[model samples]
Target chain A: MELFSIILLLVMGVATIGSAILALTTKKTDVAILAAGAISLFASIFFLVLASPDVAMTEAAIGAGLSTFLFFVILRKTEQNAEK
Target chain B: MLLSIENIALASGILLILIGLLGALTNKNIIRMIVAFSIFDTGVNILIVTFGYMPGRTAPIIDGAKVTAQNIAQVAIDPVPQALVLTAIVIGFGVTALMLVFALKMHEKRKSLDINDYTDLKW
Candidate 1:
């Protein structure tokens, strides 16, 4: 079980790093925001795998849902889609 | 090795931490940074819950039947994390609200959302 958990943890780590790299390197600000949100969503899944349902619920609700909504709201308002 | 619940929780906790770190460091927008803060908070919440779980444990409820003080004490899940998470949720909510307020204020001041545009203090 521990081994499996370790494997899952590794997978989660890879996803996190990948999304972070994308978020940082992406030229488009909107794409970066989306990647950032994806990282949060994956993190919530990681919380669920850890058997922390209460925390997982909060992560999914606030991290994934509300946070993403906030980012999208900003994106829409700013129209700052141009890459830097 | 057979999978167990403990392993599951541990995996999730680590994963959440990694993602939160990535989000915080990589995202550029101020609003996205605020969202990343919430994600990081969520990661902390996951760690708290992982601490609360005990193998072969039962709920802390007392029904006075098929549940005794010793039984509850010996196998009861830690209530500390649950309480901590509750407090964290409220605090996190407040922080998010404040972040929103700050974002709005900044936007109103600059009429811009780009973090790079705020260069008054920049060297």
Candidate 2:
């Protein structure tokens, strides 16, 4: 079990760093937003692995779910304004 | 010796903070900077939880089976950071929402997403 958890931690750490880099380097706003959301989702999983389920749930709901939705809304509004 | 999970988590959290700082500092777009800030917030939350963790422990809930009153300290992880993180998560959400609103208002006023365009107040 310890071995499995260590492997999971390594994988999550890599994914978190990779997604963060993607969020940082992406030129497109939408892609960057998606990558940021992915970072939150992975962080929530990491929280669960670290024995914090409450924090994980909050991160999943607020960070991954609501924050992404809010970003999309703003992006759409900005694009609409640009088209006008 | 191989690094423990706690050390690995701590290192990763620090790396995340650095990545977010880089993105926040370099991004030209206001919305992208906000996204980077959220990433930084997540990194802080990870660090807080990592600090609260103990090896071979369970959740901090006292269900009376796995974790009883007598063995609570021995079996359960620290609950303080989890509570603090919960508040931080909500506050982070509120702050993000406020920032997005500000971004929209700025775009409305200037018709551009570039932070460079809003240097009217600069000396």
Give interface RMSD, per candidate: 4.6, 0.8
Instruction: Provide the DockQ value for model 1.
Output: 0.20
- lDDT tens digits by residue: candidate 1, A19-51: 766765666767766775676677666655554
Please report the candidate that would top TM-score against the real structure: 2
Best by DockQ: 2
State which docking tier applies to candidate 1.
Answer: incorrect
> Which 10 residues in a row give candidate 2 chain A its minimum summed lDDT?
A75-84
Candidate 2 wrongly placed segments (more than 4 Å)? none
TM-score of 2: 0.97
- Model 1, B39-120: lDDT tens digits are 5665567567767777655556566775577677775677777667867876776777677667767876777666788889
Docking class of 2: high
Q: Best candidate per lDDT, number?
A: 2
Candidate 2, pairs of clashing residues: none
Residue B112 displacement (Å), model 2: 0.1
